[model samples]
Target: MTTIRMVGFDADDTLWRSEDYFAAAQSTFESIVGAYVGDDARTTERLYAIEKANLAVFGYGVKGMALSMVEAAIEITESRISSSDLQRIVQMAKEMLRHPVDLLPGVREAVEQVAADYPVVLVTKGDLFHQEAKVRDSGLSHLFRRIEIVSEKDVPTYRRLLEEFAIPPEGFVMVGNSLRSDIAPVLELGGWGVHVPYHLTWEHERQADIPADAARRLRSLTHADELPGALRAIAAG
Candidate 1:
């Protein structure tokens, strides 16, 4: 096995607890929508379906989520929500954005240790503005050698990063929380991947099937504190 030289990490769930805040906000938005649309199982199901469908079209971001909430509310209420209600939903979205950012357990120490020996890069996908804001606010920005805000993570993105860094796949590793976005693509490109699962992952990011190749390359971890030792083992292999 080759010594890993570059370590790429997914930002949202790997380094911090992000999605739960959004989930809470979503729940609040749903409740507001329920008031206008009539509280019931049918309305809840319809709103969830509409929100899920809109996610495919809008992608993940604060603004996209806000739009989805608005659209779902309109759809369920038959366009009858008052301007105040719409404003309230928008305010809720802003509040979600403003939720306190907390680092995942041991993430800071792990990154600090990893950066001492290898190039650490933050690779994440989302609205550029929102993602950048989080990155800047997290204060982990300085620890990374580079930051890539991608629209998606796939084989092409992984390959492109390897090429740009002039590094072989065997010399690179990706650390992230999402199996679909972070682990699978890195393994597909013959690199290594470490998965650090968060409490809440976006529904779309969940994977029903884990490819054998990905599974072979996968190292599931409970927290970022385990990363330094894990990377050492990978390098030794």
Candidate 2:
């Protein structure tokens, strides 16, 4: 019989509406840049372009995103911005850090159900401080038995985590929003994965398609509300 001993969940979009806050902050940054550049459309486009181009250089995280906003503001304003404008942009970035964490639909109920039967762990990748802060604020933190904030999610990361936890691949399940970071790597490590697609995934984490083999290895749910049922089915199988 296949028994699930540990269930690992991805943070961010998997459990909550994370990107919306970032999107709001980006819009605010673009507006600030627009005020200085004189052409709103052109300024917004240029700022977005700069943000896309800088992904490889800065990666993800609040500090990096804040820096990107600052750089974009400077670039779009042609380095002519007043001190007050620069300070507003910095203030907007700081406001993003204070955005209230809100869970996605069904996330809390799903976690509660799963926590009743199995040990749950949150496996997320981001800057340590930012990620830990979100986790602590989420109110769902107590449901998890362990938390991992990693720089990357790969086969090696999954393997080491499984070994450290004394969790066999067959007895573990990975539930997340990213096919690339959460599903594929865990599937490669011989664990099952449950994919709950998010409406807006960070561009870097997007995958071309779900591989057939990986798809076959997974049990998917359209919403977190369906998670408990999926887990029960996995157990029944």
Q: In candidate 1, what are the lDDT values of residues 93-126, reduced to their tens digit?
A: 7876776668887989999999998999999988
User: lDDT value for candidate 1?
Assistant: 0.83
TM-scores of the candidates are 0.92, 0.85
lDDT of 2 at 128: 86
Error of 2 at 96 (Å): 1.5
lDDT for predicted candidate 2 compared with the true structure: 0.83
The 10-residue segment with the lowest total lDDT in model 1: 38-47
Compared with the true structure, model 2 gives a TM-score of: 0.85
Q: Which ranges in model 2 have alpha carbons more than 4 Å from their true place?
A: 36-59
> Number of the top candidate by TM-score?
1
